[model samples]
Target chain A: MTAALHALLWIAVTIGLYGAADWLYRKSGHRAFAHPVLLPVVVLIVIFEASNLDSAKYLASTQVFSTFLAAAVVGLAVPLYRSFDALKENRVAVMVAIMGGSVSGVISALIPAWLLHAPEGLIASLLTKSITTPIAVTVAQSVGGIPAVAAAVVIVTGLVAALIGPSVLRLVGVDDPVATGVALGTAGHAIGTAEAVRRSDVMGSVAAFAMIVNGLATAVLLPLIAAVVG
Target chain B: MIKTLAGIGFLVLLLYAVDGIKQALGLPVPSAIVAMLLLTFFFASQRRVPDFVDQGAKALMRVIPLLFIPPLVAILDVRAMVLSHPVVLFLAVTGSTLVGLVVTGLLYKALVRKRGRV
Candidate 1:
C-alpha cells in the first residue's frame, strides 16, 4: 500500500509539473530559452522561493509525483529513429563538426579557466562540461573538479546555445538540415536535439549522432588534456 | 528475449573494456562515453543494430536534456549567483558560444569548399 501510494504520488507530481511546464512553453510562444525542458525547473524554483522550501523538502513532498517523467525520455526515440537517414547523407560534415566543436569546447573552457587562474576544482568540472551529465560528473570526479559545478556549467552552456542557436543559424545563412543538426548536437547535445526536432527531421538525427560522438570524444580527450596540464 | 539480454550484456562489457582502456592510459574516462563507444562498436561490428536496442537508444536520447535537471537544481546556492553575477555568466556563455560558432563555421566552410560537399 505504501509503495502504491508512493508510485501514485510520483505520477501526480511529474504530470502536474510537466503539464505546467508545457503551458509555460506555449505561453512563452515556444521560445528557445522558454522550452518545456527548462520551464518546469523555473516553476520549481519559483515555487521553492515563494514557499521558502528547501530542495530536500520539495523532493520529499513530490517523491510520489515525478514518476511519469521516466516515460518522457522514451518518446525521444521516435524522432531519433525516424531521422537516421539524414545522418547518413551528411556523415562527413557531422564528423567534422563533432571533431571541431568538441575540441573547441574543451579548449574554450579549459583555456579560460587557466588564464583566469580560476579554482582548480572548478577547472576539473569544466573539463567535462561539454559532455552530458553522467559522464560530466564522472569526468569531474576524476579531475578533482566539483561534479555539481560541472553540471551547472554544462546546463547553462547548453541553454544559452539552444536559446540563441536559431538566431545564430539565421545570421550565418545556413538553411541546411545537416549543418543545423550537427551544429546543435555539437553545441547543445540533448537540449539542442529537442529544438532540432522543431527545425527538421534531419537536424535531430544529426544531433543524436553528434551528441553521442562528442560525448565519447570528450571522455577520451579530457584525460589527455589533464595529462598535458599536469 | 535472449537478444535483448545479450545486447545489454554486450554493451556493459564493452563499457568495461573502455574503462579498462582509460585506466591503462591513466585517463579519467567518463562512464557514459564508455557505454557510447561500446554502442558504436556494436553498431560497427554488427553493421546492423537490432530494432529493440535502437528503440531503447532513441528513448534514452529523447529525455537526454532532463538528465541535467538534478545538477541544475542543485545550483540553488543563491550565494554563488551573487558572486558570479548573471551578466558575467551570460557574457561567458555568449562569448564561448560565438567563438564555437565562428571558428566551426569558417573551418567547415573551407574544408567543405575544398572537398566539395562531404
Candidate 2:
C-alpha cells in the first residue's frame, strides 16, 4: 500500500475498533469487559500479530490519533475552567487531598516494587503508575525508567481505578462528591476522570482538578524523591 | 468555522508555549500539565474562556477515551518484557492502585468531614 493509503488504513482501523468497542460497551450496559480503550488495545495487538504487520509502520500510520491525545489533554482545561467555582469553594480541601494522594501514590507504588524485588527500571516506572500516560511517560524517561513500561503501568492503574474506585469509595464511606472526585482523579488519572465525568459534571470537573494537581505533584515530587533516595 | 479553528489554534499554541517555557526553564513538569495550569489561571482571572474554545474543548471530551488506545496498543512491543515478572508486577501494580485509591479516598473524606463539622 502507498504511504498515504497505509496511514489511512490504520486510521480506519483505529476508529473502527473504537466504534466497535463503544457499541459493545453500550450493548453490555457499560461493562468494563467492553471498555473502549482496553478492548481496542487488545484487538489491535491481536490484529498486528495475526497479520504479521510491521509494528513501526503501524505506529507511523496511526500517528494522527496520538496527536489528538495531546490536544485532548490540553482540552481538559475547559472542564477545569468550568469547575473553577467548585474548586475555589473547596480549594483548601482539594489541595490538601491531592497533595496527600500524590505522595501516597508514589510511595505505595514504589514500596511494593521494592519489597517484591522488582528491577530498578520497574521501580522507577511504578513511581509514575498513578499519573496520566503523557506525563508519566515523560517523568519515567527523565528518571531513567522504561517509558513504555511506565505507560502500560499507568493504563493498568487506571483500569483498576475505573473498575474499583466508586465501589471502594462507597465501601469506605467517602460520600462527598469533592472527596470522591479527588480520589478518583488522584488515583486513576484520565480514565478515572472519564468515569467521574460519567457520574456528573461537577464530579468530573473536580476530578479534572485532582488529576491535574496530582500530575503536577507527581511530576515534581517523583524526581525530587528519586534524587533523595539515590 | 474560522472562529472554532482559531480557538483550537489558540489552545494548541498555549500548549506549545508552555512546552517552550518548560524547556527553557528546565522545569520537570510535563508541557500539557503546565499548559493546563496556565489555562486554569487564565480562566480564574479572565472569568471565561471564549465560546468557540469552550465548544471545541467539550467536543474533545467526548472522544477523549480514543486518545488512550494508541498508547495502550504501543504497549504491545513490550508485553513480553513486562509480562516476564508477571506475578510480582501484577500484584505490585494492582496492590498499589487499591492502596492508593483507598488511602486517597479516606484522607479526602476525613478532611471533608472535618471541615463540615467546623
lDDT of each: 0.60, 0.79
| TM-score for predicted model 2 compared with the true structure | 0.91
Which candidate achieves the best DockQ against the true structure? 2
Model 2 per-residue lDDT tens digits across residues A1-230: 69999999888988898999999999998886787877888888888889978877888888876666676678788778777777776688778878887777777777757777888887787788888888999999888789988888888888788877888888887777777788889889988887787788888888898898888777877788778878
Error of 2 at B70 (Å): 1.0
Best by lDDT: 2
Q: How would you encode candidate 1's per-residue C-alpha lDDT over B34-113 as one tens digit per residue?
A: 45544555566666667766544444444444444544555675337425544434444566655565455445555666
Model 1, residue B24: C-alpha shift (Å):
18
Model 1 chain B, TM? 0.65
